[model samples]
Target: MSIVRYLTHPQVQIDPDVPVPQWGLSPIGRARTEALAQASWLARTTQVISSGERKAIETAEIIAIRLGIMIEIREAMHENDRSATGFLKPAEFEQVADQFFAEPHLSVRGWERAIDAQARIVREAEAVLARNRPGDILFVGHGGVGTLLFCHTAGCPIDRVHDQPAGGGNLFAFARDGRQVVHGWRRMEEVAA
Candidate 1:
């Protein structure tokens, strides 16, 4: 069975002035991705699919370059649209995120509704899986939509409790054939361990 892994980008250079999707990976994020490129588990990943967001593209590029593969960018795979609020402080974002998850059907402050985000992510994943290619597949994206995909694959409710850790750079794997979750979230570095 092929393994399909979804990895969230690590820390990003968060700039309120820049559009969230345009934010690039911070130094820490680059270093983490560089290290992740060395993971033996990634050896089988023949396809690298990434969210169109800059941070995610940067993260995917590092691994794809090392694996000698080109990345396929999916714009619709972006994080839940928080463009309505533009940017929010950490505390504010967290609070809003909580509400976003708690009320899946209701949009929070113009942000995309949790239910809608889940549907989008699930659609994206299923579309790629339908290709039915050989070897493992790697999906590089943001934590928000990554969590949405994870929850769906795990057969769990859409909730923030299944979210990645605070600093991001986490991953979850599922079997491509069955869409069966092999594991929940784990640090990127721990993928091969």
Candidate 2:
């Protein structure tokens, strides 16, 4: 079965001063990504794609090196546009996320509406799927947008998006042709360290 696996780049070096897009994974993040490459499931992957973001690109690069495959950059796999609100301190950001999830479509305090991000994610991922042919297709992207996109693609209720953690550890696996989810969602945390 053809599988589309949505992977989120692991722990990033959080910098509130820079745009999130420009920030890359921390050393620990790189370690996590490398660990992912060594996972048994990854042995079957034949193709790879990544968001052009630094962290996502870094993750994809690790996978490409291990799998000996070229990494295709897809704009659709990019993180949600958080440019309107450049950066927030951790506690402050958590509060914002709490509000954002409550009314996902409406803008609250300058964050991009989750609905808009979700729509773009769905569109971009669909386009990516059109290019795949059997084996396994790996997509490396940021967390928020990846979760939103995966929910859209899987026909899951947006409210149940939390059924899968909203972190880099989450992976969404789906059958390419039938769009049937072979696996609903799995956490990297479940993989042995």
Which candidate leads the pack in lDDT?
Answer: 1
In candidate 2 the C-alpha lDDT for residue 165 amounts to 65
Residue pairs with clashing backbones, model 1: none
Which residue pairs collide, candidate 2? none
User: In candidate 2, where is summed lDDT lowest over 10 consecutive residues?
Assistant: 158-167
lDDT of each: 0.93, 0.76
- Residues 1-193, candidate 1, lDDT per residue (tens digit)? 8999999999999999999999999999999999989999899999999999999999999999999999999999999999999999999999999999899999999999999999998999889999999999999998989999998999899899999988999999999987899989999887763
- After aligning candidate 2 to the native by TM-score, how far in Å is the CA of 46 from where it should be? 2.1
The C-alpha local distance difference test score for the whole of candidate 2 amounts to: 0.76
Q: Candidate 1 regions off by >4 Å?
A: none
Q: Residue 1 error for model 2, in Å?
A: 0.7
Task: Single out the weakest 10-residue window by summed lDDT for candidate 1.
Answer: 184-193
Error of 2 at 14 (Å): 1.5
